[model samples]
Target: MAWPTGASPYGIGVRDAVVRGVGPRSTDGVIRVWYPAHVPSSLAARRYFDGPDELQIMTRGLGWLLSARGVRALGGWRTRGHTNAPPAAGRLPVVFFSHGFTGFVGQNTHLCERLAAAGYLVISIAYPEAAASICAPDGSSNVMSAAQRRRLVGDQFARAMVRLLRARSIDAENRAISEVTAVDTLARENDRWSVHLTAMLDALVPIDQRRARVDTATAAILDAGDWSRVALMGMSFGGSTSANVAHLDERARAAINLDGMQQGDILLGQDIRVPLLVMSSAGSMLPSGRVVNDLHYESRRTATGRVQRVLVADAGHYAFSDLVAFGARRTRGLLDLGTVDPERMLTLVADTVTAFLGDALEPGGDSGTDETEVSP
Candidate 1:
């Protein structure tokens, strides 16, 4: 992808590959990793899992689709470029990126690429049964039924089953679960789903056995003395996942949640010790904005001391993801989305997130800036 104009003082690097040993979830999906590449260094970054063959084929297919749509919508298809490694004397900070519900890691490549360019090693995980894996080369092995393939997985399936049964009791129960469910349940589900999601992450572990094994990979990477800091970020449900991860993962120094609803104990129970930043939609902050208000209130109450919340003037939740301008443009209207210029929205998110991480993780980095001011 094209680096935003202006060279990064630390320079930038890019690498992409399918993490193996991960998917094929009933449908087999592979996780993709984009990290700061360090070549000719004494220590080589290991490659984790070799995803199942079917999964690799599936990834290629999805990649093609995304590339086509992205080019048509974004004006150009940006290719990944190469850069020099970080000074061997120090290690780079690490950032884990989680995608929205039913979204793959590649969906937010634009944002993740920007973070990578800004001198951080970024790993984006693709959740199984939650992402669109490519179909096999012969156009075979794509097995998800039409219903299962829909973006809104469980809810759609539940509604269809309820309608087919014509069972009022079932319908009522589903509605109650939807209405009365606690946000903590959502957070717990995020953790639970991660159990399966870890497979995709396995691909990032270098193939070498000496450094560490798959089980201890994440810990090993986080504990590296060379790593100056660590941060977690996500959008929508992924944003909520980041909150849960930050609350539990002591290694996480900070977190950024992009328009995700707060659920479970994250809001009602646990205290967030690390610095937290919440970016929401301006429309969602208006009189009828329960999601934004509830999250803002809960975050304020739970944050120990450091917390920041801002509503992008004309942006919507999807603004943080590529869906607004990359996918079917019609999808934008489906959310009753507000009109934030796409380029401005992307820059606002990138700059705000960079500033947040800089202040919280970088030693002596500037942190006092408030809302990032972008012209309409």
Candidate 2:
């Protein structure tokens, strides 16, 4: 596997730890932090997951087809970051990241590393129940159970997708989106995830009482984070969660969604209070100049803060993920990794996101809707 290129003035340091559960409904989950650090010359880059954990996660679902040898080979991949290196001093802006459904915390470590190198504190959260594979601080591993998969994608989901894709009119499309959001099981699950994200934000912000729950090292890192200037970002279902959390949480300064359709409250008439940047894969939009699988239509109907939409040409849904670089050519082709060169795709996404965050986090604030297309 190839390491994704990142441009940064600061050396990156990463740490894996558990974030104590907040509130009555929340449960402990694994979290990895990538931040500017004082890496010594003698330190070495760390393996992707450092052990067999990667194989356990990668060898499920369609990934079951991957040979154990191939999966082990992937484990040999190294990250640019060193483990638990000394964090750089000073308060830095923070970005909270959530992974896609069935995705682990490391799904987009390249992006987290890039953001960290650029001098931000990046925290990636992993939900044990929702993730394909995740490990707690004590070394217990959790993989999504078979029953969980069936419940997540069973009959209710199939019917929703069919109605969502077949809607011919704007009203019909909105109606279909509403029905999908109304599904009790799915909606409850989305709410639970959103609460999980909120709990993370609560742990970071100094004013929140939950800060005491984090470990000493993590608390020190949090102490150096400018939580007042926070951003929420994620991919797929995680992206949708970011939008929802940003809408409800006044602490979030901005939100970014990578190739995910907005659902739940976001599609049901709630407006995101903070700025939102929705980066879509080429397939999400039609040549007719409309986004079919996203809240592009719904967002236009509901007034909100600045919303910028970017359509990446020659890209597929998974292009926004590390799979574009990690998977073999044949594997990528089978997974719809699109025609965009993997390196170029990473560069494009990182640069675009960094630029957007810079503007969105500016003091005075920004508003309005802007849509553009980029070919990498």
Candidate 3:
């Protein structure tokens, strides 16, 4: 379970730092920012939630699983020949990442690291309630109740529907039932957590206020002139979050959804001005036909008319995240959770994501390419 290694490129440097206080959560939220270390550029750091202890516990849970599978941090990937940091004056493009429900921000370390190696500033945010963050002297703690745990699992199913709805247009009867079922299921699952997720959304005195706070704070840190472009990405629940954020946030120039289910107003088809990229696991049990239709609908209706869909052959729902291999090995009964070959699966995800991000965020930059088969 060694951490996956990234391929380094010439003239590009990489470094990472954890930024605190970007969200409203009580805990000090972190934004792991990665960028080319050779330039003298300043970039705004992206932020996410700061509250919800359950999310932190979930992150730890995933980490424990990874560690059990032998995935230790191998340190940062700095170019051996290039010791000087990149100019800090020039801003690099920015990309924000959200993890799957009950997932830690670093679950997709392979993909984030590869994007960093390609000369971009990538920020992966941990949604407090949605992520699995662990805290304990020995790292053996379950912060969520049995019900909360179930909601976390159910959130995945809800997101699957969101992706499905977005790709295809539903017929009159199907649309009504799909929307009602999706909303009803989500509400039922949220109730299990005492409707914590719903409460957060409802508590926003003025819905726009929440958006304003996040926007103001993020804009201040991320206003680097060189980082002129921005993108959003997520997995599972994170993917749904990305779609929601992209729909509402004008700052995002594009978005990528990696096998996440969508919920709430996000599924109703809001206007998306930027490009949208949808990636899915070819072997997932979720309905691909529905997802394809939603994607087609969004692309055709959106102002940009730019939407791309890709399927990773033989990949499972967890293949896009670091959880696939790590979870399988660590959790005794989780073998059937994802594809068996973890390293290869990670490589495929990393390569595809890097290429897609490069093309979307840094149009002029060299978009590196890699070809690898998806393994189950």
Candidate 4:
């Protein structure tokens, strides 16, 4: 399989493995895996979205959140993907991924596939109910509604949380969530993410070599992954989940947040135990935009563990996504996707993410992230 030019540094292959997450919220969803493929691509390339409807929903939903004028209509849309191919030889570094609020697992395919091309096994989980829509392997769809969302978080204030996401100022958003709901939301999502991390680990055991938990397709790629050496990463709400999981589980070698807002107890004086990299978008540096990033940086400002906060130039919240290049940007300047070139931004993000994970997961790569600095 082949990846886009700027998406990765190497050629990669992808496969879809269905794993039934065992625990409180046992979900049956697709875990998209991207790996370094030595085998040639004999089959057709994979579809980027589960279906055209999913693509439309993602494009429009993100537009509504990031674009004041809302997402422009989709005309001709295309995606870059190579899926369900044979696994590459040799076990590779494993990295787990999470999506943003009201976003699906496949929302950040470019980032996940880019890591795969860089010789890392990348897994992006399609969140059930939490996402606006989740596509299962059996050709069905699951969409989360506002009423359902509040239940997922075990709260009655789902509308308030949604309103907060649309708030123009950080102060407004901060004020939207009271101390009680803040803790409740964080604790619930943290438990959900923790369960996901543990379930992924459990799925790593070989089917014939162990008990029956994951499907055969998942078992095929499990042997080639190093469970001992794993990393947790996410975009948007997934970032909070990744941070929370990395904090609780020592197995997470590194944690990277791609323009994700911090969540849960971390806002209430919780320290991240593992190494963390906060890659903020250009807009995040703005006075009004700094609301979420400010809290994240403050949480680790006085900590002792390795934490590097780098601000990317000419980027916005959606820059971490493929929408910048793929979506129809009808109302330009209305959305703060990024001021810099989309490809350039993604290349930098992909490179920096790989470097941080490499240093943390590998021996003697570069454990020093002492100073909080901005990238050029």
Candidate of highest lDDT:
2
Tens digit of per-residue lDDT, candidate 2, span 246-281? 878889998889987766756454455778888888
Q: Compute each candidate's TM-score over C-alphas.
A: 0.66, 0.90, 0.63, 0.77
**C-alpha positional error of residue 166 in candidate 4 after TM-score superposition, expressed in Å:** 15
* Residue 27 in candidate 2, Cα distance off native in Å: 8.1
Q: Candidate 1 on 1-376: residue-level lDDT in tens?
A: 2334334543334333333344533234333334444445453322111134534543433444344343243333343434223322236677778777655655666677676656677766655545554332233334233354453435644554344334245444334334423334343456665554344334333334313423343333323323447677888777777776676666667778888765444444345656778787764442333333343324345345556677776776777776555444565665435577666777777888887887888763423324432335
lDDT of 3 by residue, 180-244 (tens): 43565564533332233223222221334334533343333343324347677888767766766
Give the per-residue lDDT of model 4 (tens digit) for 22-121: 4333335567778876545565545665456555555544444544233333212333445656676776888988887777776677778778877888
Best by TM-score: 2
Judged by whole-model lDDT over C-alpha atoms, candidate 2 comes out at 0.75
The alpha-carbon root-mean-square deviation between model 3 and the true structure, to one decimal in Å, is 8.7
How far out, in Å, is residue 46 in model 4?
2.4
Query: What is residue 64's positional error in candidate 4, in angstroms?
Result: 7.2
Deviation of model 3 at 51, angstroms: 23
Q: How large is the C-alpha RMSD of every model relative to the true structure?
A: 8.0, 2.9, 8.7, 5.3
Clashing residue pair totals per candidate (backbone < 3 A):
20, 0, 43, 0
Question: Which has the higher lDDT value, candidate number 1 or candidate number 4?
Answer: 4
- Candidate 2 clashing pairs? none
lDDT of 3: 0.50
What's the residue-level lDDT of 32 in candidate 1? Answer: 35
